[model samples]
Target: MNPFRHGLLAARTAAVMPHRQRQLATLSAEGNAPLSVLFYHRVADSHPNDWTIGCQRFRRQIDYCERYFELIDLAEMQLRMERGESRRPAVCLTFDDGYRDNSDFALPLLIQRRIPCTYFVCTANILNQTPFPHDEAAGQPLAVNSLEQIQAAADAGIEIGCHTKHHVDFSHVHDERTVRDEIIHAKSELENLIDRPVRYFAFPYGLPEHLTQVAVDAVIEAGFDGFCSGYGAYNLPGESPFHIRRFHGDPEMARFKNWLSFDSRKLRKNFSLDFRLPASRIPTLPVPTTMTPAFSVLG
Candidate 1:
């Protein structure tokens, strides 16, 4: 950790956390506490990059979540929101970009603790045993997770989410065919490998600029249970839970606490994306056996 950076974050969090805690308490009592969905990319100590966090720091964040918030899976969190019954401060953990190193420590710790974590993977990178393009550009071609690792994660009760076939940014792609291939075809391939319905999807880059209505429609049409974006916002009660908004899980303990502890500045600026999906569209758990496809085969 950079001492100067850490010191600043520590001082900021210390100064405001008590007030933030009080605000959170009031929100919780009013049954309107915002749900925090945090997304991480990699967890390791060697050759750390902007997206990587050390294993020790990762564990500490998990411990902090256990102490202060109700940790729930994406499914349960959506359920509570749909029912308008989210009364407790809660968090859902997710990892973006499948990394082999996470299998070494981070994933195992979550599994051991029975924590709900959704691991999103770019299928082509994992399938071809290639590094993500961003990593290659950074001169650190970190190893991608293997299919066996993904299957094992699913078997261990971790939700496997799709991050597209090649981590395609939806904002750049406009055609319907490409959208279907990335959203629908990718989900099909991943489910085949894991032998379970791959329910959630997280957008690559996950910011407002990285999204398009076309891609969002494709995701909805493809029958995904929910989709996520990482634009540093919170999901509140009475909103459509299908579009999950996530904050970046930075490595610094103070930064992580400051963001998750209902930081007043962030809370004031937080706004939900208008996916235009209604609460009625929120997919129900244990989908009925008699349910039929929403659409027939596409050309």
Candidate 2:
């Protein structure tokens, strides 16, 4: 196998093992850890050109989550965490990058269901009316909601979070000042426009090692209640509020089932075995790559 494949398996295994142990611990513990999941840039409808879930698949996923997990808003999740309350396998819904379809499509569905959600918007994109780099690269127009529309969503009971000013990767950027600017200044912009406190932050393109400790500290210093990352896991009590992990949803039902049943222990064991192999051999192996964005509706 190629080194890339082997490395990928090793990485996956490393993540899964610890997660599995944690899950086993949770099962044996007094209460289940409250799970707060985060999603990014969902597509409005399934189309041949889009990388997001189609409308039907999106509905089914939402239905599944709602049925299995007690759907709670971010504020409730935060309050419970702060109060040291036990959460009963509840889920908090979040969408990142202030996609316009969030307003056009997601908002209505959420409102119709009376489901509350938080949307993290990148202020620069909304201000400049520009598309994200990936979208631009893919020849797709910007699909973020406008300032006015966001305010309206807020009026309709949706919460807004900050997703940085320019969507720059904080993990890759070196300048401390720039990191602060991206996080702090972006919070200011959103707070001003929304006429409310912007307390939550989500890292743009959140990956492992994406945001530096310094950047996370800066976000806390900037007065955010907490922050989120794109890593797949549930938040346990006393977790660093600034680096919470989230899972991505697939358009396929079977994939979603695996994600829901995903035990950190099993993951860890699988990862341990994979990590022992040559990095080159990992990708070609029959390890489940469903979690990756290969079949992503928004890819």
Candidate 3:
């Protein structure tokens, strides 16, 4: 364990945590409380990068999450949310940018355990076998999963969703055409590839500022199950479809436990569960007047 991380966590625990961990102890009927959707990018044994987690650590996390709370996929989580089922805490394992190591390492283990996860794929990269710009910039360009492997994973019961065609940023996209091509058309393209209806849509670089009402409108027009934002928050039992949230997973056991147990909602400002149709009611985000968010890397 890194002493620096320990000290920082201790300091934050003193300053940020509440007197009571009501986030954990509080619950709804039947012992359920809320939903946590953990999103990962890659899982492999070698060529480690900022986005990659070793296979062993990934397995241990799955084991731990299973022992503590119910492990579910996006579909089930939505179902539970609609049914008002929050008797026990639930988590969904989701991966962004479908990488080939997912087929080689992650798929077999998930298949064996019969645990379900959703893979958000950038269709253009998979078709072209080029690295995403983010990975390229990070100097860890890795092989992404092929069409056959993606379809095979789908065949083995893994949910496939769109991560946009080029992994384009939506925050600045003001026009409707960009939304149609990147968000709408990409979903159709992936559906054609897998021969199944792709329901979920995850935002590329999913921060609050990276989201725009235009993209949300296009996703609604295309009719998806839900969309995801990556800003260290959990889903209360009855959240709207478009306001789905995501959390980053850590491979280090101690750090992972701390992240999983921490109530990110405490960091949320003006967050609330509004389950209205036409899907508007995403919680109002704090206006980014702070210089802090630029350096913060939650996802």
Q: Each model's TM-score, in the order given?
A: 0.91, 0.75, 0.83
- What local distance difference test score does each model get? 0.82, 0.64, 0.74
| Models sorted by TM-score, best on top | 1, 3, 2
What are the clash counts of all predictions, listed in order? 0, 24, 5
Segments of candidate 3 deviating more than 4 angstroms: 1-25, 30-32, 262-299
Residue 202, candidate 1: alpha-carbon lDDT: 96
Among these predictions, the greatest lDDT belongs to 1
Higher-TM-score candidate of 2 and 3: 3
Residue pairs with clashing backbones, model 1: none
TM-score of 2: 0.75
lDDT: the better of candidates 2 and 3:
3
Q: Please list the Cα RMSD from the true structure of every candidate, rounded to 1 decimal place.
A: 8.2, 11.8, 8.7
- Per-residue lDDT of 6-55 in model 2, one digit per residue for the tens? 56755664555455445534642555445556474665773334446666
Candidate 3 per-residue C-alpha lDDT over 198-218 given as tens digits, one digit per residue, 9 for 90 to 100: 888899998877767778778
Q: After superposition, how far is residue 182 of candidate 3 from its true place, in Å?
A: 0.9
Looking at candidate 3, the ten consecutive residues that score lowest on lDDT are: 290-299
**Best of the two (1, 3) by TM-score:** 1
137-202: candidate 1 lDDT, tens digit per residue:
898999999999998989997889999999897778878899889999999998888889888999
lDDT of 1 at 173: 84
- Sorting all predicted structures by lDDT, with the top scorer first, yields 1, 3, 2
